[model samples]
Target: MMRLVASDIDGTILGHDGRISARTVRAFQACADAGVEVVFVTGRPPRWLYPLREQLGHSGTVICSNGAVLWDLAEDRLLSARAIGLEAVLEARRLIKQLCPDALFAAETVAGFHLEPGFIENPTSELLAEFTPAPLHETLTAEDAVVKFLAVTHSGTPDAFLAQVQPVVAHLVETTHSAPRTALLEMSAPGVNKAVTLAAYAASLGIEAADVVAFGDMPNDIEMLRWAGHGYAMASGHPEALTAAGYQAPHFDDDGVAQVIEARLAEEKLGA
Candidate 1:
């Protein structure tokens, strides 16, 4: 019943170590070989996605930055993108100077992340290992654009900052709690999400939303999975993600995504 398939990287397709398993790669290869349009959707920046693209070995498309950018994997280029207007964006740097003076702001661009020295220490740097950055002044008047801006406090109390800023920025942006210690504020742009990206692809191929299967395991993945014809939540996923999904896969460590794909491919063969 499904022709188009989309998957979230983190807990859905990528392993706990932030890599896709050989088994999972082969499974997705079979799907691509079977003419299923496989799309990798993630909240990661494009630079981080380059390594994943090589690892997946699939010649399809990618929806990066949680759909802020659409990349063409086969062509090795960006096809479409939606970046936050720096003018309308939350002044996380300004907020840091006022509320948490010791807090450091890191901005993600198409190139990589940039921040002031001593901004990212051991624990925080380890979490965002790939997005190391340069520094920003009161106003970052640069050529490259910023995808996302993050505030990492030296005090390790992200909630303290969120409590003070979320209400103030609520009217101007969209906020997501990726982790209790990490708050992501995505600029508002209607119809910009993994679901929308996949949906548009499905429509272009004459495949309705009813003929698609999707999988995910994060709060950022909610819309993507729910938009699929057969949506699944990883067993090791968050409670909110499980509630939003139609069924449960095994777990990332258990190769749940590969199992689901194999089963569906078998069903498709049988139907054929």
Candidate 2:
């Protein structure tokens, strides 16, 4: 029987309008009542998780920064982080710059969001206020841990950007992009994708891959989807994710995750 539900947030459970549907909420509640764990695995940084915490109305463990950090929602603290070193960060930046001169850079540290002045294109007044503007090197201190490294360009789609940069930085760091349209890439320490961290967490709980169900809608979710025994790619997911997952569910907006969970719960009840 499945004992855990691991899901990506942005395009899997949270709608584009920034709302979690009532049906999704009910399905999660049912999981909680049935003693199954629900973990949100996403490329979002910890600071971006507050709104989701409010919407969910409960706290638990969240795998954040595409599994670079493990967060405790109840305490609003980081349990652990597999951060990128300063040398790696700087080296990756240097290598990418050689290829794309105009590539903008940003870093999500344990402290907060730090960015190059133009990292975010057309920033709103609020965003401009939230991000600390500085050179990437100046933003981090020797003691600071870099959770995720972000880079973006105005030249091509995200896929194209990844194709160009991945080969260059493959030796330095792990790279992936969640946004299909934007020319942005998110990087973490080598071998620190969603699946690696999720597997560790599940092992700690004595749950095997065969007892876990996962969901996602992007390239970043590929590893996790492939690792889970029953991985569901959203019908409207990216082509890579659809190919990685063993099964497909309805689109996120159509309550695909809830539909799958509810069906499994019914099956469990019937079998019991």
Candidate with top TM-score is: 2
Report the C-alpha lDDT of model 2 over 1-272, residue by residue, as the tens digit.
98999989988988768888889989998999999998999999888886567888769999999999999989999899998988999999999999999999988888788789888777675667877678978868768799899999988899989999999999888999999689999999999999999999999999999999999999999999999999999998999999999999898878999999999999999999
lDDT string, candidate 1, 1-272, tens digits: 76877888876776546687889988988987898888787877666675566787666678877777787777878787765556545464565467667666656666556665665676466535654445665435555566665666656544455666666555544444344344433333334667877788778889988888889887667787788889898998877788989878988788999999999999989999
**RMSD (Å) per prediction:** 3.6, 1.1
Q: Locate the minimum summed-lDDT window of 10 residues in model 2.
A: 123-132
Measured on C-alpha atoms, candidate 2 has an lDDT of: 0.91
Clashing pairs in 2: none
Superposed model 2: Cα runs more than 4 Å off? none
Residue 18, model 2, lDDT = 85
**Candidate with best lDDT:** 2
In order, the Cα lDDT scores of the candidates are 0.70, 0.91
Number of colliding residue pairs in each model:
5, 0
